[model samples]
Target: MVFRPPFEEFEIQLVEVPAGETVPAPTNPGPLLLLVTRGAGSAAASGGAAASSKLLAQAELRRGSVAFVPAGTTIKYTASGAGDLQVWAAAVNAKVFAPATAEEAAAAAEPALVAA
Candidate 1:
């Protein structure tokens, strides 16, 4: 579903992935914040310039799990476990927020998944 935010600089989407399904990797034009609200899954980022296939992060999704993906990063998501994966994702312009630290920058550079 489409989500119209109070501000025009961003948008949110409700995404669902069937159990045992995977979504192909795709690059986004802006930063994306994905919050898993149900079920379980993993989101991975494809190695970029080096062409390496490495997992950036993984989590057993449940309510409040969050994943931050920076702009232009290619990401692949898989839905596993016993039920379908449901997530609330928000895409925001990268220019809107500035990384405050090296760690934050590093985290934002790849797929940083965290369980809540």
Candidate 2:
């Protein structure tokens, strides 16, 4: 078994979503893989206005749940109960150092993840 990437520029983020709080992370530049390691919660991918956004996808997260977040999508992690929710997020083909662009901003503003 072997895995190969065109370039080796990615990030593995150890995220902790506190109990009963919504945390907003920056828009991902590439595909993202998420795995819940502890506690319970839900991962939501949304786009559009902040006042009234639409959910692209919602996945129930547990101790061993997995979710996929696409590029140019904004994801929010929320923890339930009294303990924090921990998850490991791995971004592939990620351009973490790239500057933000107007097109990118607009794409993020009107995100729509389609399932095939």
Candidate 3:
């Protein structure tokens, strides 16, 4: 689904990871909020020059667990236990809500994925 706010646009995606599977880290140019819909898992995020991956957080992921990932951060997701992990992700454009100076607008339009 799609959500169009006055200042930003967000896309909702359903992500599923089978048990014992690890998904590669993904970097977003904006912020993202993930709500767990089923199962359990752990997320690891890292940013800045140090660049070392650390446990961002873990959740039982029943029905109300939510995870927030800041802009420009790299996050890796791993599914735990025998049940599949399902998450509803809402990704928002940071620039839309927090625009930079006029000169930076052009550059901010492009999205960059930082390596984890």
Candidate 4:
């Protein structure tokens, strides 16, 4: 499926991931702004561990906090502590750059894919 931004300026998706769940990775091309509203989670890029890196700009985000993530950066998130992992994912797209296909996104997200 194509990941088309919902809004004209940016798309805001209020996502809720259950406990012990982790978001795999993006399957399209777009900048993501993840605003944590409740619970705890860890974000890691392709060459990092989900719980070992502090790359993602974090915030208390209990009520109001936000973090901006650039495009082409593959990220994996694992929820910690209690409560549901709630995040507001803002997707932005520029006309100059087209979205990546599912295959491309998968290849980019994987860390050990041998180049052919």
Q: How well does each candidate superpose onto the true structure, as a TM-score?
A: 0.63, 0.65, 0.61, 0.56
- 1-116: candidate 1 lDDT, tens digit per residue: 76766775887877788889987544656767889988888876654421343444444566679877666666666888789888887887333554558886787788678678
For candidate 2, the lDDT comes to: 0.74
C-alpha RMSD of candidate 3: 10.3
Cα error of candidate 4 at position 34, Å? 1.3
Residues 1-116, model 4: lDDT tens digits: 22446445665666666777877666325667778887777655553231344654333344355666666566666676577777777776443365788997898799886678
> In model 1, which regions exceed 4 Å deviation?
47-60, 93-116
lDDT of 2 by residue, 2-115 (tens): 132556666677788889987877776677788889989887776532225444467788998887776667778889758899988888645545666999878888849777
Residue pairs clashing, model 1: none
Worst 10 residues of 2 by lDDT: 47-56
Candidate 3 per-residue lDDT over residues 1-116, each given as its tens digit = 34445555775656778888877555667777889888787766677311543445433455568977767776666788678877777887434656478778777676787678
lDDT of 3: 0.67
Q: Global lDDT of each model?
A: 0.70, 0.74, 0.67, 0.61
Best by TM-score: 2
> Considering lDDT, where higher is better, how would the candidates rank from best to worst?
2, 1, 3, 4
What pairs collide in candidate 2? Answer: none
Shift of residue 73 alpha carbon in model 3, Å: 1.2
